[model samples]
Target: MDVIERAVSVLMHDGLVVYPTETVYGLGADAFSDEAIQKVYEAKKRPLSMPISIAVSDFEMLCAVAHVRPGMEAFIQAFLPGPVTVILPARNSVPEILTGGTGLIGIRIPSHDLALRLIERFDAPITATSANIHGLKDPQTPDECTVSRELLIDGGRLSGIPSTVVDLVERRIVRRGAEADKVEQFLSTL
Candidate 1:
């Protein structure tokens, strides 16, 4: 089957699929589906306390899940479709499971076309956590990704660098990544 159709079908069925993102291979599932979201944490052996970041294709979808404030637009404009993740207050539409019962949600529009297309085609946001076991080295290639019999989309090798994470709620820097310095600079402007 085609990639888009396969991706949508898996998400609609609340199944997990590993796909390429700008930083690494990510395990994606329906962000709104509790069962699907739990599968991601289980599959990766990730802690329930550590929330996963959701990927959106556009501003409209981003706005749906997050309470977009005035300064948020400037941040999105500067780093969206890139490697920086913005933590925003969640709207009622976002599931508590996705946020790990936290009011804040991490969101991003990746620089990768395949990643963006999957979100656009699926017509829903997806939990885009790195496809790796917890505390394990993140997979840069599809084959390296340790998925358990799920649909894996190979988009060649990915950059080993993960996205720079910024917490807007705390108005401070979180863990730094590939474009850490650049992201910090951008955040300072706001």
Candidate 2:
């Protein structure tokens, strides 16, 4: 089977996969599956209180798990498909664990080719947290990734930066990472 197909198969079995993005390697799990999400937390050694982001392949997929506000669409359209994550209100279907009981979710539409294809072909959103143990350095290559995963998509080295996180509702940048200035500029117009 092809790489993405294999990744999807792994996810179908509640398996974890490490995939490369424009920024860093990401640990992907079936977003809607609580079992898969729990596995991600266990693999990363992350706290249950910390929220995890989910990656989508397109606009429609983004809308599936989030309540994209009226003006938020323009913001998402601009920075997304790049190294940026936007916080949006989560739909009821989104498990509390993913949102960390905040009722809001961080979402990304990665620009990386393999990432996009994987999520697209998986036919659902997947967990988008970086593929490294909690409090560890972001992994830019396969060797750097330390998380447990069933499939590893080695896309060579990445930028080693995390996505800049933005909260449109409060009009603020959560964490400054890749393209922070550009995201700050875009948020200024809001």
Candidate 3:
């Protein structure tokens, strides 16, 4: 089977997969499946209180999981399908486990082709947390991943820098990484 098809199969079975993103290799699992999401946390040794980000194929998929505000469309149009994680109010459909009980979710639409295709084929958002222990350096390649996964889609080296996390509800950056200034500038206009 093709790589994305294989990744989708793994995620469908509540299994973890390591896939490359624009920023880093991501440990992905079905975002709507609590069992799948728990496995991601276990694999990465990530704390349960720390919410995981979800990657979508496009803005529409993002809207399915989070409550995208009307005015925020401009920001999404400018920054998404690139390296920026926008946090928005969560829809009731999003599990509390994914949000760490905060009722907020961080979402991304990575520029990487393989990552986008994987989400598209899977037909839903997937967990997009880095494929390493919570405190360790983010993995850029599959070999650098410390976590065990059912499948690995190696897309060569990644940018190593993570997406800048912007909290739309608070109108501030939660964490600065790649393109923080650019994201800030875009938000400033809105």
**Candidate 2 per-residue lDDT over residues 14-46, each given as its tens digit:** 999999999999999999999999999999999
User: Relative to the true structure, how large is the alpha-carbon lDDT of every model?
Assistant: 0.86, 0.94, 0.91
- Report the lDDT of model 3 for residue 148: 89
TM-score of 2: 0.98
Q: Least accurate stretch of 10 residues (summed lDDT) in model 3?
A: 68-77
Stretches off by above 4 angstroms in model 1 are none
Q: To one decimal, what is the Cα RMSD in angstroms of model 1 from the true structure?
A: 1.1
Instruction: Output the lDDT of residue 17, model 1.
Output: 89
How far residue 82's Cα lies from its native spot in candidate 2, in Å, is: 0.6
Instruction: Summarize candidate 1's per-residue lDDT along 9-96 as a digit string, tens digits.
Output: 9899999989888898889999999899889989988889888989999888999999878777887787888987888999988888
Tell me the spans in candidate 2 whose CA falls farther than 4 Å from its real position.
none
Model 3 TM-score relative to the real fold: 0.97
How much is the lDDT of residue 138 in candidate 1?
84
Candidate 3 lDDT by residue in tens digits, 129-154: 99998899999877889998999998
Model 3 residue pairs with clashes? none
lDDT of 2: 0.94
Candidate with the greatest lDDT versus the true structure: 2
Q: Assess the local accuracy of residue 40 in candidate 2 as a C-alpha lDDT between 0 and 100.
A: 99
